[model samples]
Target chain A: MAQLTLVQALNEALRHELREDPRTLVFGEDVGRLGGVFRVTDGLQEEFGERRVFDTPLAESAIVGSAIGLALAGWRPVCEIQFDGFSYPALDQVITNLAKYRGRTRGRAALPVTIRIPSGGGIGGPEHHGESPETYYAHTAGLKVVAPSGPAEGYQLLRAAIRDPDPVIFLEPKSRYWTKEEVDAAAAGRLGQARIVREGTHATLIAWGAMTARCLQAAEAAAEDGVELEVVDCRSLVPLDVDTLSASVRKTGRAVVVHEAPLTAGFGAEISARLMETIFRDLKAPVLRVTGYDIPYPAAAVEAAYLPDLDRILTAVQKVLDY
Target chain B: MPSLRPDQLKELYRLMAFTRRVDQEAVALQRQGELTAFPPLTGQEAAQVGSAYALQRQDFAFPSYREMGVAIVRGVDLVEYLRAYRGDWNGGLYDLYAHNFGPIASSVGSHALHAVGWAMGAALDGGGKAAIVYFGEGATSEGDVHEAMNFAGIFRAPVVFFVQNNQWAISVPVARQTAAPIHRKAEAYGFPGLRIDGNDVLAVHAATAEALERARAGGGPTLIEALTYRLGAHSTADDPTRYRQAAEVEPWRAQDPLLRLAAQIDDEDFTRQVVEEVEERVRDLRTRLLSAPRAEPEEMFEFVYAEPPATLAAQREELRQWHS
Candidate 1:
């Protein structure tokens, strides 16, 4: 076992995938010589050569669209979108083309592609650098969207996404990329499934990526105040492990959803709606959400106010309990 | 080794002619209450057909909606293609066996990115297959197109970006699209870019074949701007006469790709035979298309996902019960 940051975990997973299967390719802006702005793909171009791990032009649409073509030709491509806000230009391809290909082809074709996006806020970065656009892809019908909270899960889930038959939108918590965790390579196979990171009986806090860590911290903090919270990491967003989530919510009799995406049409709404429908009678309180405001991701100085942190999660948990 | 034979060249001529006739038919059909719209590829046959014929069976292709000619050359049935313009489910149904030759993308320049990504994947898998993505002059302004080329250049993806610069992006000319030559955009992305006489089928064929070969050999991506013209309104929905002079259209007709190729075939007899065969094929395809099974009004709700959302499922049930 070794302690690794999320960036190192991704590098390890990519290195392993490249060695095990030559089909995996890593390329994007600054990913080659710079090993990515976040260095998640650091040292890959050197290890694998420019052919497999190289830099791309500053075009997001081409990055996503070309990945679809390459997959059709029988390759598993891993694309790096530099930041969350920059993915806007590639949205047409991601939503209209990449997400719809598998279903449009009706199983005749499988878009075996993984798009790695370093998303969410908290890095004191400039505009167009810190935003959450995962809701757009998760709202899309055909894509398999996933986010991992820590180094171990990042390594495991990335390998799974590369191996999966369908297209996977892998969103890294850019804010948490440098956060370290003791990762067990042997536990990599357990990545795709959701986990009950912490168990409590009062209410369930469902989250993923960076927010999952915050939720766990919130749950721990809430315990001292006598509000026992259950924290569940939603590892896979698309093929949502509804069975596990529903069961947990049913046991706890209360629910609180958290995410960094805008609240207007974010994924938390979907989860809350599903909970209201399936576990309505079991709820002891109204399901609530602690999410980023329904506004554009702001500058880094004010992002702390916008992103759902431990305090926000606890506030929502307490509100739901009081309800 | 040349994959194409003399007969294949003749077949290319026939396909190009069929594309021309189909353009005329689609215009007539739109006027006769048969279609909602038609994107005519009237004067750019060589750009579409030659690039299409250059592809091998393993190669992939992505087309914008106006590329009916490319679809025909890539083995998609002309009738099936019409269904797409007609707004039917069958139009979305793709033929995967012919190397995933499918319908055109309606979202302008976005498919160019899809093409690059797919080709990059092919290169990674050691498939040694190339991909060709077709777009228009207007599409060059799109961020997706630029992104695709950038990625293709960096990764050396086996893809060819075929831009049919037919001069007008629906009344916006080449000057509105970019100040720099479109081919030069490829150089900015680190690949060789070529501008060809798009109306010359021989030149189009030679350029595409060379680019495809370089890609298959893992040399890198290529960008080709096929300089040509749009002889008709952008689509049935447009009227070019209001924006451009009629004299501009007159010069392009003389440089018509179909006629140019028709004059260069090996023999006069073969050229004449190809003309008649194309006419026959067009007539048969038009009839088949006109009578093809229309999409059921309910089919619109199907195939959004592998399984429709529970809400959609409920809505479909509601529609079914209401109809019943």
Candidate 2:
């Protein structure tokens, strides 16, 4: 076991995958030499040479669409979309082609490509910099959406996404890039399954990417309030852990969903609706949700208010408890 | 390129007729309120069938919604195609093997990237399989198409981009789509590009076959713009008379590839027999299509992912409850 930051874990995974498989290639804006803005891809270009880890002409569409072609050619490409907001320009390729290619081609081709988007807010940045656009890819039928809360899950899931037979939209929480965790080497391939980071029988707080950390923080804070909170790291969002979630919600009879995406039409609504349908009879209260407001992710100064933090999550838990 | 055989010529004529008849059926069904929206490809039959016919069985296709004519030739069940237009399923029920056809892109120019990617895969795997992607001239304006072509060119991926320049994109005309000729744009990307008479099925077949052969031989990508015209309203929901002049449409009607093939064959007896058989097929397909039980609403939740998240399962049940 080794203690590593999320960025370090991600870099380790890329290095391991590239070393293990000759087909793996990494490319994106400033991903080479500069090791990417977040440094998730640091040292890769130096070790692998330009062909394997090269800088692309700042075209998000080309980076993604070309990765699709590269993947089809039997290369496992891990593409960096730089930031959550920068991913929109490539939405055409992500949603329309990358998502649908496997089913459309009837497994004749497998797009074993991983698109890494440094997502979520908290860093003082401009508009479009800190946004949660996973819902768009999650809503899309063909793509698998995954967000790792910390270092270990990030390493495991990034490798899993690269090896999986489908296209994966891997969203990394920008806020936790430097946050450290002890990664068990034994837990690398155990992806696609939700992890019970903290177990409790009172209520389940489910979140992914950046929000999962806040949920954990809220769980710690709620402990002082005499509330036992179960926290789940939703490692994979699209192929979600319904069995784990439903069972947890059934046990607790309450749930609070959290994410950095806007409230309306965000993935939280989908989760809330799902819990209500399956465990409505088991519920002591309606499933409460603490989410980003329904507006374009604002500028950095007010981004804290725009995102669901520990207080908001605690409030949601308290409301569900009172019910 | 393979020399055009008599049988091939005859098949091309028959496919054009079939495409026209199918589009005609869709339009009628829409008029009678049996269908929701019908996007007609009346004048574009030659380009679709001729180019599709030229493809080898192993070659793949990526289609925009208007390429139903090619879908028919590629073995997409006609009724399934209709079901989609009728707002039944996200697409007709055909998996990859049933017809190497892709799902219809309701969004314009989006699937172009899929074609480029697939071609790239074929090249990378040393499969020697080529792919052809079909879209409208309007698609040229889409960034995805541009990206797809650029990628294909740089990688030397074995793909032929077939654009059916049907002269209008919904209400937008071809001239407004781009200042330069659409095919010539391929030159700037470092590939050979051609503009052919789309109404000439022979020309389309010849051009596509050459491109496909070149691609298979590692000659890289080619772009063929079949300059055609749209003879009908964009879809059941459209009214073309508002934007296009009747005079402009009159000339293209005379140049109908369907009519030209029918006339050149001079086999009224063969034409009648084939048309009768096609009509029977369409009638049976319509019965099976309409009577085919509506997909279990739950199935909508089923292939959203190979396995959907708990949230999707929850939403499915929620919808079920709301419906109940």
Candidate 3:
């Protein structure tokens, strides 16, 4: 076990995969020499050489479209989309080709490709830099979406994503890149399991990606007020761990879904609806949501107000508790 | 440099004739309501067959939606290939790995990058295999095509970009698609590009063969723009008379690719035998396609992923219960 930041732990995971799997390749814009903008892939190119780790043209569609082809040709490709907002340009390829290739070929072909996107806001970057795009991928049928809240999950989940037989949208929380934790390199974790970050009986705070950290903080604050809030870190979004979520929500009897994406049609709505459908009789209060406003992610100066912070989460938790 | 012998030339003509017959039959089937719609490859037979024929067994071909001739030359089962047009499946029901042919990509120019990427893998594997991708002049204007060509040039991927410039993207003319020649687009990507008489089987075969050889020899990618004409409507549902004049169609009809190849073969007995064979095969195909089994509703839940999530599995069970 070694103490490492999320970015460093992810780099360690990538190094292990590249060294172990000869068919694995890592490539994207600036992923070769610059080691990625966040340096998540730092020292990868030098260690693996340009053949295994390389840079691509600044075209997002080709980056993903070609990855699909490479996967068809019996290669495991782990590509990056730079940032969350820029992922929209490649949405056509992701949805049309990567997500549909297996079904289109009727299981004769499998694209074991992992698309890494440094997702979500809180760093106060420029416009189009800090946006929550996980809902788009989670809603896609053929894709497996996962976002690690901290270092340990980041290390294990990325390794698992790279090894899965299906396409995985690995959303790396950019805001949590610097958070440190001890990650065991040999630890094993499955893709579709949810982790309970905090134990409480009053209510359940369901969140993923960067918002999970905020939920944990809210749980800490609620504990001080003697209102215990259980935080469920939804590591995998597509193959959602509904059993775990239902159990947690049933035990608490109150739930508040949180995300950085806008409230309308966001993934929060899906979770809320799912909870109401299952274990509706077990609930003591109605499920509420704490999410961003239904508008374009505002400029960096006002992004904090747009994103769901600890105060907003606790407010939602209080509302559910009162209900 | 890749000239065809007399026997190979005869074989090429036979494939072209078969493609034309199947295309016509598919159109007739669409008119009779057996198919949802069919894109006729009437005049582009030589362009599709010649280029696809140049590929070796180790090579793969990526085709656009209207390349029934290419699919024929690649040995894809004709009835299975038409399943997409029949609305039986998303692409078609065929063994892609066995035929070395990709699914019919309906989205224009999107699969160009796929060919390049596949070719890059071949290069990485040190296998002397190449990939050929088919598109139309209109597809050249897509952003994916530009990026695909650029990536092929940069990586020197063993790929041949075979553009069947069939003169019409639905109602839009080739002139509206590009001001400069479509072949010249390769020059911007740092590769060689050429134009050919798409109606001439010998020229089409020779150019594609040469490009494939160069790609296999690590000479990088080449772009071939075969200047053909859409002798029929864009699809069974389209009305070409809305935009183009009858006079324009008359000239292209005279320059039909099959007619040009038939004139070159110049053997009445051989042409008759080829036509008889093609008609018999088309009849068999029609019978098989009409009797093909409908897909199961549960198939929608299957093949979405190697392991369906709990939510999808529950939904699938719900659907089964409803049916029960």
Residue-by-residue lDDT tens digits, candidate 1, B1-324: 455677777888888878888889888988998877888988999999998988888887888888888888777876767777776743355565554575567788877776777776677668578888899999999877777787778778898999999999999999988999999888798999999999998789889999999999999999999999999889898999889998888989999988787777757887777668877887897788889888765666665555554456767888888778
Better of 2 and 3 by DockQ: 3
Rank the candidate models, highest lDDT first: 3, 2, 1
Error of model 1, residue A282, in angstroms: 3.2
Q: Please report, as a residue range, the 10-residue window in candidate 2 chain B with the lowest summed lDDT.
A: B302-311
Better of 1 and 3 by DockQ: 3
Off by over 4 Å in 3: none
lDDT of each: 0.83, 0.84, 0.92
Best by TM-score: 3
Question: Over the stretch B1-324, how does candidate 3's per-residue lDDT look in tens digits?
Answer: 846788988999999999989989999999999999998989998999999989999999998899999899888998889988888787788978999899889989999999999998888889599999999999999999999999999999999999999889999999899999988988999999999999888899899999999999999999999989998889999999899999988998988888888888899999999989989999999999999987778778878999888889889999999888
- Which ten residues in a row are the worst by lDDT in model 3 chain A? A314-323
Candidate 2 residue lDDT tens string, A1-323:
89999999999999999899978889889999999998889899889887678777677887887787667556888999999999989987887778776644434556878999999898887878898898899888778889989898889888888888778999999899889999875665644688888988789999898888899889999888788899888788778777778888899888999988888888888878878877889999998778899888898888888889777888889898888
* lDDT (10s digit) by residue, model 1, range A123-238: 89899888888888888876778998889899999998888777789999988898989988766554246799999999999999899989988988998998888999999887
Chain B TM-score (each prediction, in order): 0.95, 0.96, 0.98
Task: Count clashing pairs, candidate 2.
Answer: 4
Docking class of 2: acceptable
What DockQ does candidate 3 score? Answer: 0.84
